[model samples]
Target: MLPGRTWTRLLVCLTCGGVACSDDSQGGHARAHYQETDHPVAGTLEPRSTWRWCYVHRRTV
Candidate 1:
């Protein structure tokens, strides 16, 4: 991990396969990526986390 980029939760962009840290971390890299690319959805990188979030609809899909 990069300095000052500690993260407990990670998210992977479904649209472009971009991986980033979740909002629970120092920087909301996932959300930032969504804002920049409008990727719409991302799934958690946590083990056994079979869930995804839709950034546009603001809910799980």
Candidate 2:
């Protein structure tokens, strides 16, 4: 064994916070990254999101 833990164990600790788990990506990092943020603006939406450009580049013709 390493002074602390084996590399695999260390990675597991960093990823799962130590022992027992469901999703490997089920830890503080996951929770912090994928938190439920539910609060849509009442009634105001652009015809389309500028973010669309991220998924599919747009070209003005």
Which candidate number maximizes lDDT?
A: 1
Q: Each prediction's TM-score against the native?
A: 0.84, 0.15
For all candidates in order, the CA lDDT equals 0.90, 0.23
The residue-by-residue lDDT of candidate 1 on 1-61, one tens digit each, is: 7786688788999989999988778888999999999999999988888889998998999
How much lDDT does candidate 2 score? Answer: 0.23
Residues 1-61, candidate 2: write the lDDT tens digits.
3254222111212222332221222342222222332211111123443311110122211
How close to the true structure is residue 56 of candidate 1, measured as C-alpha lDDT?
91
Q: How many Å off is the CA of 39 in candidate 1?
A: 0.3
Residue pairs with colliding backbones in model 1 are none
Find the candidate with the highest TM-score and give its number. Answer: 1
TM-score of 1: 0.84
Estimate the Cα RMSD of every predicted model relative to the unseen true structure: 1.5, 16.3
